[model samples]
Target: MSLLSKIAEIEAEMARTQKNKATNYHLGLLKAKLAKLKQQLISGSSGKGGGGGTDGFDVTKTGDARVGLVGFPSVGKSTLLNKLTGTYSEVAAYEFTTLTCVPGVFKYKGAKIQLLDLPGIIEGAKDGKGRGRQVIGVARTCSLILIVLDVMKPLTHKRIIEKEVEGFGIRLNKKPPNITITKKDKGGIIITTTQPLKKIDDETIKSICHEYRISNAQIQIRCQATADDLIDVIEGNRVYVPCIYVLNKIDQITIEELDILSKCPHYVPISAHHEWNLDGLIEKIWQYLDLVRIYTKPKGQIPDYNAPVILKSAETRVEHFCLRIHKTLLAQFKHALVWGKSVKHNPQKVGKEHVLQDEDVVQIIKR
Candidate 1:
């Protein structure tokens, strides 16, 4: 059967479990996961060659913007989710506390984004330990992944975390994941960052080098003042959606560690339970989500902001929306009345060739 069908099967089982008194975290995770799977299938990525893109799943079609929190257990993925969405995920001082996926929604300037806190994964997570296939599947389904790291001493966990993330990326269609260095407490000088240096041991580095050959993309970054999210955003990488990195538990990081973190790009320091700079995090994420509020009205009616208006990308056109509404609209489409300055849709009678702009209301007249 097609991958879509397979995803449907899983979704059906999940629905049953959810109705049969399943846990909210698990139900939420399964539902969100099914949504992602359906999206990939709709975009034609369900082909046999597995997912095809470095940015998690390869969606050749219009896909939702999904942000996932990824890290080993106790690194604060759940805590961050709790703080960001008020989900009240069980937080503890140990590993493997989060056994299931937790999904929550966050709003930034009227745009709602899906935030996922996946179960904690460890070394060889993709190989079978700790439900590796499931966890890897969760991360693989995301459009973007937020890697969290503890900015503490020893540097062993840091290296392990980075290595594991990169390694897992390699295993899943050679996708390149965004990194987030999370710091807990304060003590050391400052962390330093340099362009991501390939550790030779990291297969992602080798795979990326082999794939791109000459193109250069840095990997590592130290937390800094200007850093509020992932390196792709901090370094001005042309990204489809914006990403933010939270260095949780800033109270645990030392000044010396801060010096090291400052080497790459500066990230935001936050305490998940204390509401420290949480709004800043929300604003930054909202800005990157590319959310637009569009108003809609039928015929000669006043634009109703409360109406269910379709939200799409800034560049999405009327024809694109037409297909979404109905495939036959593309063929039977006549002229449409446009409000606001959509450039393509604003003027007199426009055909399917019209492109839509943010907040532009439209009325289509077809035979």
Candidate 2:
């Protein structure tokens, strides 16, 4: 489902739940946000929840944005989710270990982005890699897909996974996936019989960046960078997808790997087992994604001056947001008074069909 539609769904649900929870402060705030969301939906601006024109790629009604993690088994995709969200997904060192999508929430920048661990996608998985056909289901629901690579095989591994998603009809622009290096603290750690780390050239990292459409805007190519600026640059480039890098097994890699690691963007040298970069990973993740929230209040007399504001991703009529507060309030709905924002749309008394905007605190004077 589109993100905006999901947000609309949330609004409707919140409105229904408001009846018994009228005094709940959070519910009131959620209702105010729902008011904004309903307006967004009515105006057909539910494309990408980003606050802008009607020209969004694809926005669902709900703030529930899905970031799907897909890769062949043993690439440590599940382990990434576990480290990031504390999800208890089974991680085995074998082929096709994950057979379905395991969903968990990962917050970036005060926004909740749903993370899904899809089964090990194979070459023909798009055509239903054994039972991997559910990718279509996952794609249909998720807002973005994070293509995880073990960094061992480098580009070769990512290429295969890309093909599967395309075949399954998951159309995405060069949307940059949070392309994680996974086991950072494992410098001396052992997982498989992979070769010892070796120095990878600019062209190689660039190739991976190109595959993910990440732009290398800064950094000196010839000289070496032991500092963390290069890493921040890469993490900053992640406006749309997974925004950080988890440098798996840093303690185990050769000097060549360490040299490369220092320059990578948002690289957190951590081992999931050893729990090294876990906090940094979380902080980076929160810093990288976009989230839209709406703050709302019930259809009561007035709201507190400092009540929490709900954020809605779409354009919803104020009345619609009110409906979220009470189906009956929408029925006995009168005009609304908006208290926030620069623009003034004085409560031009109407029915329970008013639309709202960001920071527009409301007082839904009902019948």
Candidate 3:
């Protein structure tokens, strides 16, 4: 039988199989097998495999960060893209109008953020139905995801989109679980944890590792994680990203309905056509990206506020800032004077290893 057909069969068996302590190990093994098959299908390694990619939908990733817009058909994603970035993405009153990825640039706080308007994905998208896997493939590369939805449609659409993305190993609004696995050549499988594991058990872990053929490995799980999270680390293709639900077309809904949607966790209600509540959305994006802006002050002149060197929080160091400006600066650099929250006193002299903060003013003094 074909891989897809076998996958269907396994899924049917899993659905038929009831959950109990006696069947947990079997269920875990089946889940691992299902994940492996899905991974193969996504990597284009199985029979009748063509889905698992963006093909021509791949756009050049520019700017500081890339945010992808994903949702169902006719959810006003293209309209939102046009309103936010002033880029013309064809918009119509029908479904599937956007058949590919549309790229746009949104400049906020002197940062050029790349916004991608992906084609609306349907229910069985991760299984290669329509352009679902390809569309999700683009999303996996995004720094953040904006799950756009229509307030006029059933809210269940949100759940379906979440499932499709999750199936493709995209963890939305979640951080990578604090789990570590170290493989060994001689030692047998050893498990250690500082805290109790609620979602995953030792037996489940052993079953998953057995399915992956990991015979000798040391596993350390620090937090309460699920079998899926452990499998994600084992598979090593998962993308953990923050997501903001952009509930669109609020103008078509009542005030009470808008209030309800606004209260939903991680969601921002807006009218993309009317450009309502968009500033809040932009602010949320900036907050989630966790970017730090450093203003460069010349030795004798004031700092220019029009443009600031943007750096991610993890790489916001004096040396990193200099490297971003010019590679030669690091070789010729002597010290940097910082005037921000990162330093103790005003204009403190610091070395290349000094970390920077948001809106920090820096002056590089060469030897």
Candidate 4:
């Protein structure tokens, strides 16, 4: 049997199985097995090598961040791409208009964001059906996913798209579960937790470990997690990414429908064809990207506001900023004077370890 077929069988069995005290261990084992099989599918254990860049769908990543437009066909994705980035992607009233990945640049707030218009994905995408795997594979490398939806179509399409993305090991708008596992040679499975785990028990963990052939390991759980989250850690290929639901074609909907959609979490309703609410979409993208911009000033000179060095929020240290400019800057740097939200006093001198904040002004003094 094929791996996908085996996965389908396991899923069917899992669906029929009852989830109770007596069946938790069994369900955990099944999930572990299913996860293993999906890994095989992605790795191309069947000799096809999975969905590599052979399909020409994976484009070169550029700019500060990449946002992929994903949805079913005729969902105004191409129209939005054209309006947002001023790039031409073929739009049609038919299904499957976009055949490959179309690249565009979205310049916003002095940040050059790469916008990727990917081909429409169908059901059973994770199973290598219709270019869905290739489309989703490209999405995995993006910093953010713009799940475009048609307001005229049924909202159920959102759930289907989400399921397909999840099947490919992409966790949308979620953080990695607070769980860690360490392998040891002699120590038996030692489970520890900072707080009570309500979703999983010791028996289920043991069963999952045994299924994965992990005899000795240290397990730590810090928050509520399910069997799937545990399996995600064990399998280790999952990507947790933030997503925005872009409900397109709001011009056709009534004001009541627009109000309803506005209340939904992480969603922005817009009419791509009419070019309505495009600024709102761009602003939301900027907020979700969590990027920091630092303006550079020479000694005894004003800060350059025209061009700014952009960095991720996590790595905004003085050393990181130097490394971003040039590798040699780190060795030549003595100290940096910062004037902005990152510093208490204006133009305060700081070291390499000093953290930087958004819109901070920096001046590096050479050693």
Candidate 5:
């Protein structure tokens, strides 16, 4: 049987199998096998003559961060791109209007954000349908994903798009599982957990590991983990990213319906055509991106407030800030005087390792 056929057979079996303590091991093994098959399919397709070349989808990474607009065709992705960035992406009332990746840039909160309007993806995108691989490949590189959906059928489209991205190893709005697997030469599978295992057991874990040909390894479960989590760790190629569901065409929906959608988490309802609630969308994007703005203060001079240095929240250390300014700045750096929420006192002397906070004023004092 073909790889696709084999994958389908395994999926069918997994669906038919009941979930219980007795079937958990079987299910775990099946999941491992399924993940392996999917990996093979991805590798094979990306190889020579596999037709997985991302020719036009390779957009240059510019700006402070990148966000991708992904959804079914004619779902207002192009319209959103145009409205937000003033970049033409061939807005149309038809599906697949934007055939390739179209990139645009917009500035928000002193940060230059690059937004990409990707081609509309169809079902079975992970299996290489409708140039889906190339579209999703670009998505994997995004810092955040804006899933543009038609407000009328938002949930239906959301689920399909989520599945398509998930199938391609993109875990939207989720953190990586707290499971660690270390390979060894000889000692058999050793399982350790800091918390109780509610969703997965030792036998199931062993079965999953064995399926991946991992005979000797140390597995540490830090939280309540499941078979899927174990499988994700074994696969080891997952991308965890935040996603905002841009429910477009909200002008067609009633106020009551819009209110209901507003209650949903990570959802921003807007009318791309009429340009409604776009400010809320931009705010949510800034929030999800978790960026920190550090104002530079020269010695005996006022801090540069107009052009703040933008850094990701996770990389807001004094060293990172210096590196952002210039690579050689770190070599001449002595210490930083930080005046913000990150420091206990205003203008506290801090080392390069000190982490910075948003809206912080940093004055570098070199030796």
Candidate 6:
């Protein structure tokens, strides 16, 4: 049978199977088989006219961070890009208006954020339908994703879009599972867990592993994860990204409806054409980006507040700061004098290994 046919058969079987302790192992095996077939389909190993390469857009990465605008056609993605970055993306009332990826840049909190207006993706995007792979390929490179949805449309569109993205190995607003698997030479499957396993059992884990052709290995579970989580860990190619659901055309909705929509987490309501609640969107973007702004101070001179060195929150060390300024700065640097919440006292002498906080001022002392 064809890979797609095989995949469909397994899916059908999985759907037919009842969910209970008696069927967990069988369901896990089916999931593993489905994941393997999908991977093969994506890589074009199925030999059924699948493209081996991702025909992604040829957009150069610029600025300190990148964000992507993704959604169905004519859902204000183009409008959002144009208004936010003052870049034209050919807005229209018809579907599939933006054919290619349109990139725009804007500065916020001393950091330049690059936003890409991607082509609208339809259902079955994960299976390479409607420029889906190309759009998702660009989205995978983004630091954050803005899923633009029309408030007038059914909210079911959100779930459909999310499923499409997830099928392409993108885990939106999720963390990696705290499960670890190590392959061993001859030992049998060794299972260890720091916490109790409630969602998945030992047999199901083994069944999934066996389907993946893993025989001798040690598995460690640190969290209460489900069968899907175990499968994700086995696949090992998932990308966990932050996503914001941009509910556009809120101007057409009633005030009471808007209030109800506002209660949803990670959702921002706005009228892209009217420029409503845009400041709130920007604020939320800044918060999710988790950027650090470090000011440079020359010896016996005031800190330069006009421009600050921007760094990601995870890479806010003094060494990273120096590298951002200049590669040679680290070679000549002895230490840094930091003045911020990161330091106990103002203007504390610290080494290059010291981590910096947002809006911190620093003076470098040469060796």
For every model in order, what is the number of clashing pairs? 50, 72, 0, 0, 0, 0
Candidate 1 residue-wise lDDT, 1-367, digit = tens: 8654666587577667734222433443444444344444334422234532223222222224567777777878888898777776788998888766677777554455677777776876433345444555556556556666554532465455444443333221122244433333443222335444322223332232233231334434433312112322322322232334556666677778755654544255566656666786666555555555555556767777664344556546777767656788778877777777675434457666777667777777777
True-vs-predicted CA distance for residue 253, candidate 6, Å: 1.0
| Error of model 6, residue 82, in angstroms | 0.3
Give the per-residue lDDT digits (tens) of candidate 2, residues 97-133.
7765676776554456677777776675543335445
TM-score of 3: 0.94
Among all windows of 10 consecutive residues in model 1, the one with the lowest summed lDDT is 225-234
How would you encode candidate 5's per-residue C-alpha lDDT over 1-367 as one tens digit per residue? 9988988999999989998988888888888898898888877654246544777787899999999999999899998999999999897788888888999999997889999999999999898777888898899999999999999888899999998898889999999999889999999999999978988899989888888889999998998899989899889999999999999998898999999999999999999889898999999999999999999998889999888999999899999999999999999998889999999999799999999989999999887
Candidate lDDT values, in order: 0.54, 0.50, 0.89, 0.89, 0.91, 0.89
- lDDT of each residue in 1-367, candidate 6, tens digit only: 9876887798799889999888888887888888888888766632225653434377999999999999999899999999999998998899999888899999998889999999998998887677887888889899999999999883888999998898788999999999999999979789999988877889888888888889999999999898889989999988998999999999999999999999999999999999999999999999888888999999999999988999988899999999999999999998889999999999899999999999999999998
Local accuracy of candidate 3 as per-residue lDDT tens digits, 246-285? 8888888889878777887888988888999999999999
Query: Once superposed on the true structure, which residue ranges of model 6 sit more than 4 Å away at CA?
Result: 45-56
Clashes of 3: 0
**Error at 22, model 4, angstroms:** 2.3
Error in Å for residue 353 of model 1: 3.1
Which RMSD does model 5 reach against the true structure?
Answer: 1.5
lDDT score of residue 213 within candidate 6: 85
State candidate 6's TM-score.
Answer: 0.95
lDDT of 4 by residue, 1-367 (tens): 9887899999999999998878888888898998888888877722255644446674888998999999998898898889888899998999998988999997887889999998998988888887887888889999999999988874789999998999889999999988899999978899999878887899899889998999999999987889999999888889989999999888888999899989999999998888899999999999999999999998777889988999999899999999989999998998999999988999899999999999999999998
For model 4, give the 10-residue run with minimal summed lDDT: 45-54
Candidates 2 and 4 compared by lDDT, better number = 4
Compute each candidate's TM-score over C-alphas: 0.55, 0.48, 0.94, 0.96, 0.97, 0.95
Identify the leading candidate in terms of lDDT: 5
